[model samples]
Target: MTRESSNPKPSPNDKIYGITNIKSYVPLLLDLDRLNYDSWKELFKTHYIGYKWLYGTLTQSVLQSILKPNATAADVWKTIEDLFHENKETEAMELDDELRSITIGDSTVMEYCTRIKSISDLLANIGSPVLERNLVIYAINGLSHKFTHVVTTIRHQKPFPTFLEMRSMLTLEERSMAKDHSRHVQASHQDNASSPTILTTEYQNRPSHYRLNNTRGRGGGRNQRGGSRGGQNGGRGGVR
Candidate 1:
């Protein structure tokens, strides 16, 4: 007892002795759905160097998934890494599918292009950036049927347009379509204004035969008036 050394070895469980729940110390939770693994990892890196501390930061589902009997901290850490790695692939594919499935219905050209660019940016964050050319194609593919001509022009161009160029071209095409539609509406209105205004009730109630006979009667009356005026002029000339 008198030969005890001044320096003593620390117990293996020294780090975990006072810790009851690891999660209470951590400020945030790890959520796969929100894609916050990066933040969760950064916060977790500060605490205990091993994976056991991660059990506190993780959600119940994540904790349950990595839990194993007699599993070491290293084993748990590897499992977490593997799960996130697999998740990245699955997320990338799902994002790519979302990109391909987008449509430009009821959205302006700028809005549609911005939406696509946003998705591409997200993909890049996940280490799966979409090629610029493919992005252009994706934007073109999502345009409405009315933009078929613009899509064709973009596809046929040599040295395909950049994403910004494509967006500008689509915006111009949208304006052109809007102008054409406006002009067509104005022309339609003008035609309506110039046309005869038939009373709906009278038109619906009158028979075809009655309208025909009325038109003929009006023509006969005009002819009779002209004959009477002519005869009166001839009589005046004879007297002269």
Candidate 2:
């Protein structure tokens, strides 16, 4: 009966004003334990400027806990923040314990250091970043006994090297140790090649043909000597 309003409300399907299929935009489901909060927050913040559309990205459990029919985006986001941020201290402690116990065991130096860096990154993500000095110390502590000398050298430096520098020094030291081991093995082989004891062992280990030929030669000599003695005895008997 009345004239239509000048500015009608935009439909939910309006291209610029509406968000369709939030799951397509933000694929990650928010978990209760907050392990993925940082990543989930970044994606959610990027896709939608509005908060109402966030419910679809949460797990059913998280959704039931945070959802209310009258709740606004800010309310839900604050609830999420409270749930995730409150446990940062506990998470940091657990991560610190993990970093402390990491070891180099059969892993190469690169792999060992990469593991330390990964844990450090996770700590940083949780707002409990490890200092560079402490990171280096953690890495050095985890090394196997073979790196003891390098570890001592690293600790003794006036200004401790960066983790990368320390890793480089250790890599070089490992190469040097390998080279020295190779040289020692070669020298041992040379020494064994020239040693009388080793040569005797080698002689005894020679093929059966070589031993058999030598034994045949010795047997011939003994037989010839016995024949000479028998001929001499025959001559003596004739003289008698």
Candidate 3:
């Protein structure tokens, strides 16, 4: 019969204690890379320009204050440092760069990363508003009622009766958006069929323009960077 000891220390190398046990960190980073690249690819194809914003010191510093148990930057920093075994300050300059290269292969990943980071910083300064929240603002400005009338007539139904109903309904504004998007898709299809397609993105790579062009003596247009990302629409046309 032995009494339980009160003073027990945990092992430093325990699975839950050390950063080395964080087997999923690298995987999470990979997943983020894939998601970001896919999103960039689709946006590029759609001719969407990216932008960014930045967070102010006070609002961002206070962001953790309303958490369930309450928190501070110090607390959050400690968590990162303890889990990653490094100084978190060195991690957050209020800005960090992590962007991938475009598949065009003309731009360096770092140059594009700088632009993406600038856009992110811009978003931070604006304190992003949840999209639906702005509907009321639109309503106050009269745009909502105009669309509401258009939608009711098209659908042969009553105006938006409840927010829940709005969730599944395609209102007039949405219809217009869909119509515009469909037109763009049709236009691109026509353009691609026509050939000499100057394309964009970081997706499942189409194909390299040429491998070892100097050795192979291939012919092609040279992009602005003098890096060989130029070629025919559906051919092997990428040079690094």
Candidate 4:
């Protein structure tokens, strides 16, 4: 996508404390990728559509993480150059948090939470905000909710779901919710054709091999044979 001239760059007057200039942040960014996320760097290249976007996102996330709430654009850029010394992600409870703390941290999280909490004002925001918003939701839910909000939302899961899967899930959530809501409207309209037919089909005699006890977010559980779900989600597509 071509950069639009209408979109203004940060003004010098805007003081973003705690972040570094994109150029100065290069070494630290590379270090972040190598220290624990080396695999992601390669995967970013492998991803065809958003290679540059993912890299820029990594950069943007890193900038947002270190910046304080009151920081200006310059403050953010300046802080980035001097952010942290060692790999402090190991200190964070989840690997994604550790990375995001230095990568996309509280600022991004806060912004996203704000957006989700206020769906009405979303249109006033920028384009294609779902990815970031979904990420924020995932992070927040992971910290609080009872779903498999692991190191990150399943949407952002690296290997199995990939970035694409997250988008799909987000889309699916919207579609499912819309369809679910449509039932009420169909009742008001009294048009039988307006209502969607409910189909609860069961796969007859299906093998029980796929069943396991992976509750939403309470952690592992037993299988049909009552054995521990050793893999713990068994969906570890995370890029280490």
Q: What TM-scores do the predictions have? A: 0.51, 0.59, 0.20, 0.22
Model 2 per-residue lDDT tens digits across residues 120-204: 8778767788989988898889888898999999999978899899989989988999999999999998876757887798888
What TM-score, to 2 decimals, does candidate 3 have? 0.20
Highest lDDT, which number? 2
Q: Give per-residue CA lDDT, model 4, range 1-240, as digits (tens).
A: 457777767764343332333324333243333232333334433321312332343555564566366655456434544443233433332334432333223333344334343331221121112345444544345332322334345645555454334444545554565686798887877755432343322333344553332242234322432343434445454433
Residue-by-residue lDDT tens digits, candidate 3, 15-131 = 333433222322221111112222322323232211110011112323233222444544543432243323233433332322122121333323433344443433332332223
What lDDT does each candidate get? 0.81, 0.83, 0.34, 0.40
| TM-score for predicted model 1 compared with the true structure | 0.51
Q: How many residue pairs clash in each candidate?
A: 0, 0, 19, 20
Superposed on all Cα atoms, model 3 deviates from the true structure by an RMSD in Å of 28.5
TM-score leader: 2
lDDT by residue for model 1 over 146-165, one digit each (tens)? 99998999999988999999
Considering TM-score, where higher is better, how would the candidates rank from best to worst? 2, 1, 4, 3
- Model 4 has an lDDT value of 0.40
Indicate the worst ten consecutive residues by lDDT in candidate 2: 11-20
